[model samples]
Target chain A: MEKELKKIEKVISNLELNSQAQIQELLKNFLKTHLKKSKIDNFIGDYPTFIEPVYLNVNVKIGDDVLLGPNVYIGKNTEIKNYVEISNSIIFDNALIGENVKLNNCIIGKNTLLNCENINIDNCVLVGNVKTKEDVYRIMYKFK
Target chain B: MSEKRKQEIQRIKELESINLARDEIRDLVIDTKKEVEKDNDLLAAQINDELNKRGIKSIDIVGAIGAGKTAILEKITEKLSKKYRILVICGDITTRVDADRIEKHNAETVQINTGRECALNAYHINQVIKNKDLFDFDLIFVENVGNLICPSDFKLGTDKRITVVSITEGEWVIEKHPMLFKMSDIAVINKIDLLERLGTNIDKMIKDACGFNPDIKVITTSAKTGENIDTLIEALEL
Candidate 1:
């Protein structure tokens, strides 16, 4: 990661800005370096330019276009879909989540299909191919 | 030639794309691992609260396909419902027929149609359960999506987690899903009538179950033969 970051840094430093497009690439790459370490801000679509870092933010990356409707609470470049509820759910990537789901302490693998709801998952490592018939409510419900 | 430079640039672009992809995946893993660890602690604290409150007498029967979960549910539900005003939550990713099947046994059927997957959390169960008579019923039997691994990970405010496995599946059924077996409060070994024919030793089932959970109550029954049906009923009296 460090080497890759350094290479990207070199590209940012060396890229000749002949047009607005080249300038945009330089800025995006430059921004991604810092953005990688910090939390992303929330927006409907199209991630914003990197400025300041925040704690517990979301980022919607490429291939994650059309993320959560109303796009509440995003990190940096993390892709979510519409119909996904935003209430203390931390999403990773390529996570093909279904509609009207409440996620807490759930680490969904890349490209895993979470096609259900009321899922309270914790202390579990799902390497994709996780299929459920009903909600897996944990001891967390006891607190509520 | 400029062609060589262009090709070099294209190669660099491709490599950069791949690198970006790798970086994104790695960072997500690191961040996710930390987040899940944090969530575990948060959930533990929340669970501690849930347990101290008035826990509903809901039960989640977890097992694999052909483990006779449905049969045990029918047999046990027939009895548990009589005393507890039971409501059966049937989950089968497709069709309400399972709910209908259980309904014939005189229990209100809640068919959770979440495509081809299971509801491994309590929120969805609570969502549908809230619409019904939660307080009126003494027991809400959620027949989980015939999965041992995923169902055990979730604790659905249930008084008991009944794990069903047919003696025909083998004595090693208890060891097949260690996590599920370990999490279960009760282990029902169905098809005990077929034990001799299936060459299953009851002692092995008891030993394996006890190995996972010393407090695990093991009951042997044959839902088809109606053997030990009374015993299953007696166990649920608690």
Candidate 2:
């Protein structure tokens, strides 16, 4: 029984580390390909908001004064409100991103309504009905 | 194995269990969304039957905030009131300001205050008209809550659905909101008088609208200047 338990631990640890590395690699390549095809148009508003250094799906409605990219992917029908800065993130479709939020290295899930303001999310996978103003952080290393 | 090693195995086993449960939860969510859509469709068909029986033609107008949905409706009411008994139903987050504005143009107005709800669903419309005599009007205009995303998912039991956007919203508005264009019967590009000053390419917007929806009718109008309002009326057949 003890030998079997040790083997299981070794297998689980290896699987966790390998999956994390593989996901990071896949997401990086995906964002790189999509960013090359993204078109940055001048968002003509009072504040003059433009998504610089980001890859955006054409169906995203972005508000004024939002800073996006270097490595970001926003999917279709996602509405980003004013004064939000996001970098190195993947926001899925139908997400209602509220105002004054900052995100870095985050993977926001589909149909998630993020109503938080002025909160910084880093190195997290916020998924499935995450509607709160509290600062949330879930490091990816926990899977190991 | 050591004490810590045993705990690690147990934790991995639990994590696998949680992952399986998460997949089930995701499936449940998808099923619920489809169920809601099916219910909305059934309700919309019922409402359409009711409206048809009463000889009332309904239109649901959807757009982003400040996209001139109200301006187009105001112009529509002004022109068609002399010929038809029009009823304008305005859906707002928390104000009757649009209802008041449309009422001035000789249309009976009803205000639906959908507090914090992004979209006006068919169930709300069914309840709104259930108490009223819908036969008194020949046409009904429903201005859905000002949003580009949520309103696209709803069906308001209307004969025609219009998605309105203005040049000031940006030249990419049409491409940025593909779902609304795909579902709408008519796409109105308003505020064209300011097109040159804003330097927006109206052609690109029209092309994008047509690309998403080949069957959709695209009309460029300046509601402020009343340009192409007559053409829009003709398209609406009002």
Per-residue CA lDDT of model 1 for A17-130, tens digit only, reads 343354334333433343333233333344222111222234443222121211122334344444343322233344555544544323344455655544445323233444
Candidate lDDT values, in order: 0.57, 0.75
TM-score of each: 0.55, 0.57
- Angstrom error of the Cα, residue A139, model 1: value is 39
Question: Lowest-scoring 10 consecutive residues by lDDT in candidate 2 chain B?
Answer: B109-118
Q: Write the per-residue lDDT of candidate 1 for residues B1-238, one digit (tens) a residue.
A: 6999999999999999998899879978999877755665455345334433534466678887778877777877776666667777776654555666777777766655443344445544554553343566656788887776777656665667888888777777787778887878888888887866778888988899989999888888888877888887677655
lDDT of 2 by residue, B74-169 (tens): 998999999899988788765567977998999987666554468888866775576356768999999999999999888989999999999898
Docking class of 2: incorrect
Task: Please list the residue runs of candidate 1 whose C-alpha ends up more than 4 Å from where it truly belongs after superposition.
Answer: A1-144, B1-24, B30-55
The residue-by-residue lDDT of candidate 2 on A48-117, one tens digit each, is: 1222235555577777656565466776678888878776677776777788888766667667778666
Q: Which candidate comes out best when scored by lDDT?
A: 2
